[model samples]
Target: MATPGTLVLAGTPIGRVEDASPRLARELAEADVVAAEDTRRLKRLTTELGVTVGGRIVSYFEGNESQRTPALLEELEAGRRVLLVTDAGMPSVSDPGYRLVAAAVAADVPVTTVPGPSAVLAALAVSGLPVDRFCFEGFLPRKQGERARRLAALAGEERTMVFFEAPHRTEAALAAMAEAWGDDRAAAVCRELTKTHEEVRRGPLAELAAWASDGVRGEVTVVVAGAGPEPGVAADDDSLRAAVDEREAAGMTRKEAIVEVARSAGVPRRVVYNLVHSKGPR
Candidate 1:
């Protein structure tokens, strides 16, 4: 019996086609089965590389990933080398290859990766911010309330945060970030990375928010400075009570308002509520 073939997750260039590794070209031409997130894009890539795919080409994207994983795994089990490629960057990083990779691992199939261009690292490197302790947040939630809640949770995070956002919603997201993270905090908005119109704008969150209000085009990534040292404010009973009252007056339910104030003030929500109703809402 022939040994089972390996499952290869290959990375494609984020923008420039010349950035594709030679090994990626060879693997694309030689694999027994080629699974691509966008087959049309793969065809274009193969045309650029001047290589003809000798293997079977299948579409594997977000919509079909769940249904396609089993089929791909069967080919790998049958000793067919399966190469997975995404439209840009590595497959499975906020892309459509995780299900297949998980299936391959669960079936005891060997899997490997071909490192290639990554917008995440590229944006971080050029952001003029500290990279040693940075975190990738992928993308923010789309809904206004959900996005605000997500940002609220990160208010106390110390690691610099990176995020991807659509051009259309960049202004709203940045504005919401400013409201949650403070207007004066520093950030960078890196756009059209690795492309001809690449641009990086760095400034206070409020300023970026205002700039984005007019609009921004192309792909975008944002890097934000982490929450700086805690402010020298006392989180005493009186202060906590005052904050809860402020939020409650602004429209949040009493419970919701307490949590919001506690998070922003860097104190426990329960501690604030206890201070408010020590003998139960007089």
Candidate 2:
């Protein structure tokens, strides 16, 4: 019986060839099968790193991952270590490699990772946003309605939010964020991290959107400050009720709305509930 092999999810450098780690080079040279999102890019990376891959290289991207996964699994079952590398950063993070990893685990094949550079982490580290707690939102939907709905759901997310955006869509995405999360919401647009011409712009969502309007370039990652304090805590009862009303309009029940309102306002639920019941719409 052939011993089952290991599946390694290796991270490639997002930019700058030197960012490639020695361990990554070693893995590329040692793996029995190298599955790459873009074989051309993989070749370029190997050449730049001065490392020759000692294995068969195959394309394993979105278009053919389904058909290719079974074949890759066969190699693993036959005791061939399979190394998965995306074009940039880590695999399965808004990239290919997730399905194979899931399959490997199901077959009891050992799966490990060679952690390296990540654009998401790189953007976050340099964005200067609060990172004690944050969520990686990957990419927004291309459809405007779907994108708006997605942003709406995150409207109340208190944790810092991270997102990837293509250079072309960067401006539009920022505009949509401004509309959904409030134009005054704090945000940073990180472009081309770790590469020459890298730029990070920090300001309110509206300001960032307007700045990108002139046509920004390069890969983009956006970090937006979470929703700030709930609306109008210092205002009268009518204002508190209005905040709850907005949440309820978004499909939250009265109790749920009250809880969220109070949490955001940093006040007790009882205070919000009292005001909500006493308020008359102005």
Candidate 3:
């Protein structure tokens, strides 16, 4: 009987090539069709592994993923053991190959994975921050305003956050994060992980932003501490009103003013608003 068709989604080394798993090398050498995000990188990896590709190879990157998925799926349906790889890390985690994997699954083709290195987990593990509850935010939007807005939305998020960023924009992103999440928030910038010049810089957001201002290089992963506990409540109604009035005087609208006082005083917004209205101005 002929071998059943299957789709293998393999994880490549995020940094050092030595991190590649034995199973990855074997699959690459034996796959009947290899779809890679970067054919050049795939070729180099195969050469480094001393594993000759015994199958047809094709490019499948962000630009060509839509066009390539169907073609790769066709190969899989034809009883070809199609193996998908990305430039780095797992194929489909902030990389190409997800669509192809989904297609194979819908078609009832066997789907499997060759697990290996991951920058997200690596950064989280080394970061002194809590990793018990976290979320992978992938890469932030490139536009400055959009990125700031996205970061602002997460200001109240209680879970630790992981983000991938380019070297050149790391400083700007860190600065925006500081503005949205307070300068004192703790964070770590992990650069060139697993490589000879690997570095993990940990500090308050402001300090990390300052370091990156001088310019950063290599792949970067950032792990940030989650929002801290809310502050203690104001001692009395007079103190809470004074806080709200101070915020309102600073040009914040009434609702914004109330929210500010609530967050700072660790009181509910509705409660603050009721007190302000009951006290009737001043």
Candidate 4:
């Protein structure tokens, strides 16, 4: 006659420990098992928060996730409340947490969230770009060709796009984005957000690329404006697909080209994507 256990996904402060919610503090102190992305960082956070962790601390990161998931589920099945947290932000967002969530869902285990600060939202809020409709692209592929393909896929996206990049690769990624998205595309580079050195640089992609070329430091988040309407192109499926085809042939990706084509043809990007992938040439 034991109560069913619940899994709690807690969002930690991205920076500034004061941002930690009261619920986070209560969960950290009360959960039966606490799974953290980095135990060392978790200890530092708890120390900063001046709160003591009463639950058993366990490491749950990319490297050990597969091996540890089953064990965590066992604790849950035993009616032990398990709290999942990442070093920053919510779990499963370019971080560890997806697999366990999927497994939990499959097992019908109850899952809940304690939302808090997020780099994605924080960046978008200060990005000076349209936030009403935006897309989170997380981190792009590392290889040059792969990265190009990814950017090209998003070429015509009209909604603001947010991305996470390593400081070392920001310049190159910006450069590639400039080429795929056009040099004139407006973008914002948020560095060390919410931290003492937090900086937001807004400009065209080309300008951002030039600035980053000298090298930058700290965590980085990028927000780029979506493509504007193109003149002259008729708003028909045929013209749209042709436009995308032309861009792709010129080295743009089908994804990137489709967006650009959609913008030009005055159609939703999804329509273009569907037409571009729809079996045969139109």
Winning model by TM-score? 2
Q: How close is candidate 3 to the true structure, as a TM-score?
A: 0.80
The digit string of per-residue lDDT tens for model 2 on 116-174 reads 99988887888766777889999999999999999999988988899999888999999
The segments of candidate 2 whose C-alpha lies over 4 angstroms from its true place after superposition are: 229-282
Candidate 1 to native Cα RMSD, angstroms? 10.1
Q: What overall lDDT goes with each candidate model?
A: 0.86, 0.87, 0.86, 0.87
Clashes of each: 0, 0, 0, 6
**Per-residue alpha-carbon lDDT of model 4 for 1-282, expressed as tens digits?**
455588999999988899999999999999999999999999999998888999899999999999999999888878999999999999999999998888888878899999999999999999877788989999999999999999888877878899999999999999999888766567899999899999999876888999999999999999988777435566676877678878988999787777566545545566778877885664
> Over all chains combined, what TM-score does candidate 1 have?
0.80
lDDT accuracy of residue 143 in candidate 2: 94
Instruction: Between candidates 1 and 2, name the one with more favorable lDDT.
Output: 2
Enumerate residue pairs that collide in model 2: none
Please report, as a residue range, the 10-residue window in candidate 1 with the lowest summed lDDT: 228-237
lDDT of 1 by residue, 27-68 (tens): 998999999989999999999999999999999999999999
> Candidate 4 at 14: error in angstroms?
0.9
lDDT of 3 at 22: 94
lDDT of 2: 0.87
